[model samples]
Target: MNKLILSAAALALMAGAATADTVRMGTEGAYPPYNFIDDDGEVAGFEREVGDELCARAELTCEWVTNEWDTIIPNLVSGNYDTIIAGMSITDERDEVIDFTQNYYPPTASAYATLTEGADMMGGVIAAQTSTIQAGYVAETGATLVEFATLDDTIAAVKNGEVDGVFADKDALVPFVEEQGFMFAGDDVPLGGGIGLGVRESDTELKDKFNAAIDSMKADGSLNALLVKYFGDETAQY
Candidate 1:
Protein backbone atom coordinates (compact mmCIF):
# COMPACT_ATOMS: atom_id res chain seq x y z
CA MET A 1 0.00 0.00 0.00
CA ASN A 2 2.86 2.39 0.81
CA LYS A 3 4.49 1.56 -2.51
CA LEU A 4 1.28 2.43 -4.35
CA ILE A 5 1.04 5.76 -2.56
CA LEU A 6 4.67 6.55 -3.34
CA SER A 7 4.16 5.76 -7.00
CA ALA A 8 1.12 8.03 -7.22
CA ALA A 9 2.99 10.88 -5.51
CA ALA A 10 5.89 10.50 -7.90
CA LEU A 11 3.55 10.61 -10.86
CA ALA A 12 1.85 13.72 -9.50
CA LEU A 13 5.18 15.45 -9.04
CA MET A 14 6.21 14.58 -12.59
CA ALA A 15 2.96 15.91 -13.94
CA GLY A 16 3.40 19.15 -12.02
CA ALA A 17 6.89 19.57 -13.43
CA ALA A 18 5.66 18.89 -16.92
CA THR A 19 3.05 21.63 -16.62
CA ALA A 20 5.54 24.24 -15.41
CA ASP A 21 5.34 26.04 -18.71
CA THR A 22 8.21 27.93 -20.25
CA VAL A 23 7.46 29.73 -23.51
CA ARG A 24 10.55 30.25 -25.59
CA MET A 25 9.78 33.12 -27.95
CA GLY A 26 11.62 33.90 -31.15
CA THR A 27 11.80 37.17 -33.11
CA GLU A 28 13.80 39.03 -35.69
CA GLY A 29 15.51 41.57 -33.50
CA ALA A 30 16.60 43.57 -36.54
CA TYR A 31 13.15 45.01 -37.17
CA PRO A 32 12.83 48.25 -35.28
CA PRO A 33 9.67 49.29 -33.46
CA TYR A 34 8.54 45.69 -33.77
CA ASN A 35 11.40 43.65 -32.29
CA PHE A 36 14.86 45.12 -31.90
CA ILE A 37 17.79 45.30 -29.52
CA ASP A 38 18.01 48.44 -27.48
CA ASP A 39 21.19 50.11 -26.29
CA ASP A 40 21.10 47.90 -23.21
CA GLY A 41 21.29 44.84 -25.50
CA GLU A 42 17.88 43.67 -24.35
CA VAL A 43 15.03 43.08 -26.75
CA ALA A 44 12.70 46.08 -26.65
CA GLY A 45 9.98 46.89 -29.16
CA PHE A 46 6.28 46.68 -29.78
CA GLU A 47 6.34 42.97 -30.40
CA ARG A 48 8.56 42.35 -27.39
CA GLU A 49 6.24 44.25 -25.11
CA VAL A 50 3.21 42.44 -26.54
CA GLY A 51 4.90 39.07 -26.11
CA ASP A 52 5.79 39.86 -22.51
CA GLU A 53 2.19 40.81 -21.80
CA LEU A 54 0.90 37.60 -23.40
CA CYS A 55 3.30 35.48 -21.39
CA ALA A 56 2.17 37.19 -18.19
CA ARG A 57 -1.46 36.66 -19.07
CA ALA A 58 -0.88 33.04 -19.94
CA GLU A 59 1.03 32.42 -16.70
CA LEU A 60 4.15 31.31 -18.47
CA THR A 61 7.76 32.32 -18.12
CA CYS A 62 9.13 33.59 -21.44
CA GLU A 63 12.66 33.68 -22.79
CA TRP A 64 13.13 36.01 -25.77
CA VAL A 65 15.60 34.84 -28.38
CA THR A 66 16.65 36.51 -31.62
CA ASN A 67 16.56 34.49 -34.80
CA GLU A 68 17.00 35.42 -38.42
CA TRP A 69 13.75 36.28 -40.15
CA ASP A 70 14.00 33.47 -42.71
CA THR A 71 14.66 30.78 -40.12
CA ILE A 72 12.13 31.74 -37.46
CA ILE A 73 9.47 29.26 -38.55
CA PRO A 74 11.86 26.44 -39.29
CA ASN A 75 13.46 26.88 -35.87
CA LEU A 76 10.10 26.71 -34.17
CA VAL A 77 9.24 23.50 -36.03
CA SER A 78 12.61 21.97 -35.12
CA GLY A 79 12.02 22.62 -31.39
CA ASN A 80 14.54 25.47 -31.19
CA TYR A 81 11.76 27.80 -30.07
CA ASP A 82 8.35 27.25 -28.55
CA THR A 83 6.69 30.40 -29.87
CA ILE A 84 7.31 33.04 -32.52
CA ILE A 85 6.31 36.59 -31.62
CA ALA A 86 7.82 38.17 -34.64
CA GLY A 87 5.61 40.27 -36.89
CA MET A 88 5.00 37.16 -38.91
CA SER A 89 2.10 37.14 -41.31
CA ILE A 90 -0.55 34.43 -41.13
CA THR A 91 -0.87 32.90 -44.56
CA ASP A 92 -2.50 29.74 -45.79
CA GLU A 93 0.88 28.55 -46.99
CA ARG A 94 2.33 28.97 -43.51
CA ASP A 95 -0.75 27.39 -41.94
CA GLU A 96 0.19 24.16 -43.67
CA VAL A 97 3.38 23.99 -41.61
CA ILE A 98 2.54 25.66 -38.25
CA ASP A 99 -0.34 26.95 -36.20
CA PHE A 100 -0.86 30.66 -35.48
CA THR A 101 -2.44 32.35 -32.52
CA GLN A 102 -5.03 35.10 -32.89
CA ASN A 103 -3.67 38.07 -34.74
CA TYR A 104 -2.12 40.58 -32.37
CA TYR A 105 -1.35 43.05 -35.14
CA PRO A 106 -2.31 43.90 -38.69
CA PRO A 107 0.26 45.04 -41.24
CA THR A 108 -0.16 46.32 -44.79
CA ALA A 109 2.36 46.61 -47.58
CA SER A 110 3.08 49.74 -49.61
CA ALA A 111 5.45 50.95 -52.29
CA TYR A 112 8.01 53.68 -51.79
CA ALA A 113 10.02 55.44 -54.47
CA THR A 114 13.12 57.51 -54.04
CA LEU A 115 12.67 61.24 -53.66
CA THR A 116 13.49 62.21 -57.21
CA GLU A 117 11.88 64.58 -59.71
CA GLY A 118 10.78 61.73 -61.99
CA ALA A 119 10.13 59.27 -59.18
CA ASP A 120 6.55 59.10 -60.36
CA MET A 121 7.86 57.83 -63.67
CA MET A 122 9.58 55.01 -61.81
CA GLY A 123 6.57 52.80 -61.37
CA GLY A 124 7.30 49.46 -62.94
CA VAL A 125 9.42 47.19 -60.76
CA ILE A 126 8.47 46.45 -57.16
CA ALA A 127 10.91 45.08 -54.62
CA ALA A 128 10.30 42.97 -51.52
CA GLN A 129 11.98 40.46 -49.32
CA THR A 130 12.23 37.05 -50.83
CA SER A 131 9.75 34.36 -49.70
CA THR A 132 7.48 36.91 -48.06
CA ILE A 133 3.80 37.51 -48.74
CA GLN A 134 4.79 40.90 -50.14
CA ALA A 135 6.93 39.15 -52.71
CA GLY A 136 4.06 36.87 -53.61
CA TYR A 137 1.82 39.89 -54.06
CA VAL A 138 4.34 41.51 -56.33
CA ALA A 139 4.40 38.35 -58.39
CA GLU A 140 0.64 38.08 -58.56
CA THR A 141 0.31 41.71 -59.58
CA GLY A 142 2.62 41.02 -62.52
CA ALA A 143 5.04 43.70 -61.32
CA THR A 144 8.66 43.20 -62.18
CA LEU A 145 9.91 41.75 -58.90
CA VAL A 146 13.23 42.52 -57.28
CA GLU A 147 14.00 40.34 -54.28
CA PHE A 148 16.29 41.39 -51.43
CA ALA A 149 17.53 39.69 -48.29
CA THR A 150 16.56 42.47 -45.90
CA LEU A 151 14.20 45.40 -45.79
CA ASP A 152 17.10 47.82 -45.71
CA ASP A 153 18.54 46.24 -48.80
CA THR A 154 15.29 46.57 -50.66
CA ILE A 155 15.03 50.23 -49.68
CA ALA A 156 18.61 50.76 -50.67
CA ALA A 157 17.95 49.28 -54.07
CA VAL A 158 15.10 51.70 -54.56
CA LYS A 159 17.23 54.61 -53.36
CA ASN A 160 19.98 53.65 -55.78
CA GLY A 161 17.55 53.36 -58.71
CA GLU A 162 18.10 49.62 -59.01
CA VAL A 163 14.38 49.19 -58.47
CA ASP A 164 11.45 51.46 -59.21
CA GLY A 165 9.74 51.03 -55.86
CA VAL A 166 10.05 48.91 -52.72
CA PHE A 167 7.17 47.06 -51.15
CA ALA A 168 7.31 46.38 -47.44
CA ASP A 169 5.41 46.38 -44.21
CA LYS A 170 3.63 49.68 -43.78
CA ASP A 171 4.81 50.21 -40.21
CA ALA A 172 8.48 49.72 -41.06
CA LEU A 173 8.44 51.39 -44.46
CA VAL A 174 6.66 54.55 -43.33
CA PRO A 175 9.32 55.47 -40.81
CA PHE A 176 12.08 54.34 -43.13
CA VAL A 177 10.91 56.48 -46.04
CA GLU A 178 10.46 59.49 -43.81
CA GLU A 179 13.96 59.11 -42.43
CA GLN A 180 15.51 58.41 -45.83
CA GLY A 181 13.64 61.14 -47.71
CA PHE A 182 11.79 58.71 -49.93
CA MET A 183 8.34 59.32 -51.34
CA PHE A 184 5.59 56.83 -50.60
CA ALA A 185 3.34 56.11 -53.54
CA GLY A 186 -0.40 56.11 -52.98
CA ASP A 187 -0.78 52.45 -53.81
CA ASP A 188 -2.38 51.41 -50.49
CA VAL A 189 -1.71 47.81 -51.41
CA PRO A 190 -3.11 45.07 -49.22
CA LEU A 191 -0.92 42.22 -48.14
CA GLY A 192 -1.99 38.62 -48.47
CA GLY A 193 -1.82 37.83 -44.78
CA GLY A 194 -2.19 39.12 -41.20
CA ILE A 195 0.39 39.11 -38.43
CA GLY A 196 -0.01 36.56 -35.63
CA LEU A 197 1.89 34.54 -33.06
CA GLY A 198 3.36 31.30 -34.42
CA VAL A 199 3.65 27.91 -32.76
CA ARG A 200 4.43 24.39 -33.74
CA GLU A 201 1.52 22.27 -34.88
CA SER A 202 1.90 19.96 -31.89
CA ASP A 203 1.58 22.81 -29.40
CA THR A 204 -2.19 23.10 -29.44
CA GLU A 205 -2.41 23.90 -25.74
CA LEU A 206 0.18 26.64 -25.95
CA LYS A 207 -1.48 28.02 -29.06
CA ASP A 208 -4.82 28.18 -27.29
CA LYS A 209 -3.24 29.89 -24.33
CA PHE A 210 -1.62 32.45 -26.58
CA ASN A 211 -4.86 33.06 -28.46
CA ALA A 212 -6.73 33.57 -25.20
CA ALA A 213 -4.12 35.98 -23.94
CA ILE A 214 -4.23 37.90 -27.22
CA ASP A 215 -8.02 38.05 -27.11
CA SER A 216 -7.88 39.41 -23.58
CA MET A 217 -5.33 42.00 -24.55
CA LYS A 218 -7.39 43.05 -27.53
CA ALA A 219 -10.51 43.31 -25.39
CA ASP A 220 -8.73 45.40 -22.78
CA GLY A 221 -7.21 47.66 -25.49
CA SER A 222 -3.66 46.83 -24.50
CA LEU A 223 -2.84 45.68 -28.02
CA ASN A 224 -4.17 48.90 -29.52
CA ALA A 225 -2.30 50.92 -26.93
CA LEU A 226 0.95 49.28 -27.88
CA LEU A 227 0.28 49.74 -31.59
CA VAL A 228 -0.46 53.40 -31.12
CA LYS A 229 2.53 53.92 -28.89
CA TYR A 230 4.89 52.47 -31.47
CA PHE A 231 3.34 52.91 -34.90
CA GLY A 232 0.96 55.79 -34.18
CA ASP A 233 -2.83 56.06 -34.42
CA GLU A 234 -2.82 55.62 -38.17
CA THR A 235 -1.49 52.09 -37.80
CA ALA A 236 -3.85 50.91 -35.10
CA GLN A 237 -6.03 48.04 -36.31
CA TYR A 238 -7.34 46.50 -33.07
Candidate 2:
Protein backbone atom coordinates (compact mmCIF):
# COMPACT_ATOMS: atom_id res chain seq x y z
CA MET A 1 0.00 0.00 0.00
CA ASN A 2 2.58 2.54 -1.01
CA LYS A 3 1.65 5.81 -2.72
CA LEU A 4 1.62 4.22 -6.16
CA ILE A 5 -0.74 1.41 -5.11
CA LEU A 6 -2.99 3.92 -3.35
CA SER A 7 -3.31 6.09 -6.47
CA ALA A 8 -4.69 3.17 -8.52
CA ALA A 9 -7.11 2.12 -5.77
CA ALA A 10 -8.25 5.69 -5.30
CA LEU A 11 -9.13 6.02 -8.96
CA ALA A 12 -11.21 2.84 -8.80
CA LEU A 13 -12.95 3.86 -5.58
CA MET A 14 -13.78 7.32 -6.94
CA ALA A 15 -15.78 5.75 -9.74
CA GLY A 16 -17.98 3.79 -7.35
CA ALA A 17 -20.34 5.96 -5.20
CA ALA A 18 -21.11 8.20 -2.20
CA THR A 19 -23.50 8.00 0.78
CA ALA A 20 -26.49 10.02 2.01
CA ASP A 21 -26.97 11.44 5.53
CA THR A 22 -25.68 9.43 8.49
CA VAL A 23 -22.12 10.70 8.08
CA ARG A 24 -19.80 7.75 7.68
CA MET A 25 -16.71 8.75 9.71
CA GLY A 26 -13.58 6.82 8.66
CA THR A 27 -10.53 6.10 10.86
CA GLU A 28 -7.55 3.77 11.31
CA GLY A 29 -8.50 1.97 14.51
CA ALA A 30 -5.03 0.43 14.85
CA TYR A 31 -3.46 3.65 16.20
CA PRO A 32 -4.07 3.85 19.93
CA PRO A 33 -5.20 6.88 21.97
CA TYR A 34 -6.22 8.69 18.78
CA ASN A 35 -8.39 5.73 17.61
CA PHE A 36 -8.77 2.03 18.33
CA ILE A 37 -11.34 -0.65 19.10
CA ASP A 38 -11.67 -1.39 22.78
CA ASP A 39 -12.15 -4.80 24.39
CA ASP A 40 -15.89 -4.49 23.82
CA GLY A 41 -15.38 -4.74 20.04
CA GLU A 42 -16.50 -1.14 19.57
CA VAL A 43 -14.69 1.89 18.21
CA ALA A 44 -13.48 3.60 21.38
CA GLY A 45 -10.74 6.20 21.64
CA PHE A 46 -10.08 9.95 21.80
CA GLU A 47 -11.13 10.67 18.23
CA ARG A 48 -14.22 8.54 18.71
CA GLU A 49 -15.52 10.67 21.58
CA VAL A 50 -14.56 13.88 19.82
CA GLY A 51 -16.25 12.84 16.59
CA ASP A 52 -19.43 11.86 18.42
CA GLU A 53 -19.63 15.23 20.17
CA LEU A 54 -18.90 17.11 16.96
CA CYS A 55 -21.69 15.24 15.19
CA ALA A 56 -23.97 15.98 18.14
CA ARG A 57 -23.22 19.68 18.01
CA ALA A 58 -23.60 19.75 14.23
CA GLU A 59 -26.93 17.90 14.54
CA LEU A 60 -25.66 15.29 12.09
CA THR A 61 -26.25 11.59 12.60
CA CYS A 62 -22.88 9.90 12.24
CA GLU A 63 -21.56 6.34 12.43
CA TRP A 64 -18.00 5.12 12.93
CA VAL A 65 -16.27 3.08 10.21
CA THR A 66 -12.79 1.62 10.46
CA ASN A 67 -10.73 1.49 7.27
CA GLU A 68 -7.11 0.65 6.56
CA TRP A 69 -4.94 3.76 6.83
CA ASP A 70 -3.33 3.34 3.43
CA THR A 71 -6.65 3.42 1.55
CA ILE A 72 -8.45 5.73 3.99
CA ILE A 73 -8.22 8.85 1.83
CA PRO A 74 -8.89 6.93 -1.39
CA ASN A 75 -12.03 5.45 0.14
CA LEU A 76 -13.12 8.92 1.15
CA VAL A 77 -12.78 10.08 -2.46
CA SER A 78 -14.56 6.97 -3.72
CA GLY A 79 -17.55 7.63 -1.44
CA ASN A 80 -16.89 4.74 0.91
CA TYR A 81 -17.03 7.30 3.74
CA ASP A 82 -18.16 10.87 4.23
CA THR A 83 -15.41 12.04 6.59
CA ILE A 84 -11.98 10.95 7.83
CA ILE A 85 -11.48 11.57 11.56
CA ALA A 86 -8.35 9.55 11.77
CA GLY A 87 -5.15 11.08 13.22
CA MET A 88 -4.42 12.69 9.88
CA SER A 89 -2.63 16.03 9.62
CA ILE A 90 -3.66 19.12 7.72
CA THR A 91 -1.13 19.18 4.90
CA ASP A 92 -1.09 21.08 1.64
CA GLU A 93 -0.56 17.92 -0.43
CA ARG A 94 -3.58 16.20 1.14
CA ASP A 95 -5.73 19.32 0.98
CA GLU A 96 -5.42 19.30 -2.79
CA VAL A 97 -7.90 16.40 -2.91
CA ILE A 98 -9.85 16.76 0.37
CA ASP A 99 -11.14 19.53 2.64
CA PHE A 100 -10.30 19.59 6.32
CA THR A 101 -12.00 20.85 9.44
CA GLN A 102 -10.12 23.14 11.82
CA ASN A 103 -7.52 21.11 13.63
CA TYR A 104 -8.71 19.10 16.64
CA TYR A 105 -5.20 18.00 17.65
CA PRO A 106 -2.31 20.44 17.62
CA PRO A 107 0.87 20.06 15.56
CA THR A 108 2.77 16.96 16.63
CA ALA A 109 6.21 15.41 16.31
CA SER A 110 7.09 12.17 14.53
CA ALA A 111 9.65 9.96 16.25
CA TYR A 112 11.44 6.69 15.77
CA ALA A 113 11.05 3.64 17.98
CA THR A 114 13.37 0.64 18.07
CA LEU A 115 13.94 -2.44 20.13
CA THR A 116 17.65 -1.61 20.56
CA GLU A 117 19.76 1.49 21.05
CA GLY A 118 22.04 3.36 18.61
CA ALA A 119 19.55 2.69 15.83
CA ASP A 120 20.26 4.76 12.72
CA MET A 121 16.88 6.22 11.91
CA MET A 122 18.41 8.47 9.23
CA GLY A 123 19.63 5.72 6.87
CA GLY A 124 18.83 2.27 8.13
CA VAL A 125 15.73 0.34 7.16
CA ILE A 126 12.69 2.19 8.57
CA ALA A 127 9.12 1.04 8.74
CA ALA A 128 6.22 3.50 8.48
CA GLN A 129 2.49 3.43 7.87
CA THR A 130 1.88 3.85 4.17
CA SER A 131 0.63 7.16 2.74
CA THR A 132 1.46 9.00 5.99
CA ILE A 133 3.67 12.00 6.59
CA GLN A 134 6.11 9.76 8.43
CA ALA A 135 6.27 7.44 5.47
CA GLY A 136 6.88 10.39 3.19
CA TYR A 137 9.60 11.63 5.51
CA VAL A 138 11.23 8.23 5.63
CA ALA A 139 11.42 8.23 1.85
CA GLU A 140 13.13 11.61 1.90
CA THR A 141 15.67 10.36 4.35
CA GLY A 142 18.44 8.07 3.13
CA ALA A 143 16.81 5.14 4.95
CA THR A 144 15.28 2.19 3.21
CA LEU A 145 11.53 2.55 3.69
CA VAL A 146 9.28 -0.41 4.42
CA GLU A 147 5.63 0.52 4.09
CA PHE A 148 2.98 -1.21 6.19
CA ALA A 149 -0.79 -0.97 6.06
CA THR A 150 -1.14 -0.31 9.80
CA LEU A 151 0.93 1.22 12.59
CA ASP A 152 0.92 -2.16 14.32
CA ASP A 153 2.54 -3.77 11.32
CA THR A 154 5.37 -1.24 11.29
CA ILE A 155 6.08 -1.85 14.98
CA ALA A 156 5.94 -5.58 14.43
CA ALA A 157 8.54 -5.20 11.69
CA VAL A 158 10.91 -3.68 14.20
CA LYS A 159 10.27 -6.34 16.87
CA ASN A 160 10.50 -9.22 14.39
CA GLY A 161 13.88 -7.98 13.02
CA GLU A 162 12.37 -6.93 9.74
CA VAL A 163 13.40 -3.29 10.05
CA ASP A 164 15.77 -1.22 12.16
CA GLY A 165 13.03 1.02 13.56
CA VAL A 166 9.52 2.32 13.00
CA PHE A 167 8.67 5.96 12.45
CA ALA A 168 5.34 7.44 13.54
CA ASP A 169 3.71 10.16 15.62
CA LYS A 170 5.60 10.40 18.90
CA ASP A 171 2.46 10.38 21.04
CA ALA A 172 1.08 7.32 19.27
CA LEU A 173 4.33 5.44 19.99
CA VAL A 174 4.75 6.65 23.61
CA PRO A 175 2.57 3.96 25.15
CA PHE A 176 4.53 1.22 23.41
CA VAL A 177 7.88 2.56 24.65
CA GLU A 178 6.48 2.75 28.17
CA GLU A 179 4.87 -0.70 28.22
CA GLN A 180 6.65 -2.82 25.65
CA GLY A 181 10.25 -1.88 26.49
CA PHE A 182 10.79 -0.18 23.14
CA MET A 183 13.38 2.59 23.10
CA PHE A 184 13.06 5.99 21.53
CA ALA A 185 15.75 6.37 18.86
CA GLY A 186 16.90 9.47 17.00
CA ASP A 187 15.49 12.97 17.25
CA ASP A 188 11.81 13.67 16.71
CA VAL A 189 10.81 14.83 13.25
CA PRO A 190 8.50 17.83 13.38
CA LEU A 191 5.74 16.92 10.96
CA GLY A 192 2.09 17.86 10.35
CA GLY A 193 0.41 21.22 10.83
CA GLY A 194 -2.25 19.72 13.11
CA ILE A 195 -4.74 16.87 13.13
CA GLY A 196 -8.10 17.53 11.41
CA LEU A 197 -11.17 15.77 10.04
CA GLY A 198 -10.99 15.27 6.27
CA VAL A 199 -13.87 15.45 3.80
CA ARG A 200 -14.15 15.38 0.03
CA GLU A 201 -13.68 18.47 -2.19
CA SER A 202 -17.36 18.68 -3.08
CA ASP A 203 -18.53 18.56 0.54
CA THR A 204 -18.00 22.17 1.56
CA GLU A 205 -21.10 22.30 3.74
CA LEU A 206 -20.13 19.16 5.64
CA LYS A 207 -16.65 20.55 6.27
CA ASP A 208 -18.16 23.81 7.54
CA LYS A 209 -20.40 22.00 10.04
CA PHE A 210 -17.47 20.07 11.46
CA ASN A 211 -15.38 23.24 11.52
CA ALA A 212 -18.04 25.02 13.55
CA ALA A 213 -18.23 22.06 15.89
CA ILE A 214 -14.47 22.17 16.39
CA ASP A 215 -14.53 25.93 16.96
CA SER A 216 -17.30 25.51 19.53
CA MET A 217 -15.26 22.96 21.44
CA LYS A 218 -12.13 25.09 21.27
CA ALA A 219 -13.95 28.18 22.49
CA ASP A 220 -15.50 26.28 25.38
CA GLY A 221 -12.17 24.61 26.31
CA SER A 222 -13.79 21.21 25.77
CA LEU A 223 -11.21 20.36 23.11
CA ASN A 224 -8.42 21.14 25.55
CA ALA A 225 -10.05 18.87 28.10
CA LEU A 226 -10.08 16.01 25.63
CA LEU A 227 -6.45 16.68 24.72
CA VAL A 228 -5.47 16.31 28.34
CA LYS A 229 -7.70 13.31 28.84
CA TYR A 230 -6.13 11.39 25.99
CA PHE A 231 -2.72 12.93 25.29
CA GLY A 232 -1.70 14.18 28.75
CA ASP A 233 -1.27 17.79 29.93
CA GLU A 234 2.26 18.31 28.62
CA THR A 235 1.14 17.89 25.01
CA ALA A 236 1.36 20.81 22.56
CA GLN A 237 -0.42 23.85 24.05
CA TYR A 238 -2.57 24.42 20.99
Stretches of candidate 1 off by over 4 Å are 1-19, 107-109, 117-123
TM-score per prediction, in order, is: 0.86, 0.89
Candidate 2 colliding pairs: none
lDDT by residue (tens digit), candidate 2, 35-131: 9999998888999999999999998888889998888999999999899999999999999989888899999898999998998888899999999
* Per-residue lDDT over 44-142 for candidate 1, one digit per residue giving the tens place of the 0 to 100 score: 999989999999999998898888877788899998889888778898999999998878987565554555545442337778887778787778765
Residue 73's lDDT within candidate 1 is 85
RMSD of each: 3.3, 9.6
Q: Let me know the TM-score candidate 1 reaches against the reference structure.
A: 0.86
| Residue 47, model 2, lDDT | 96
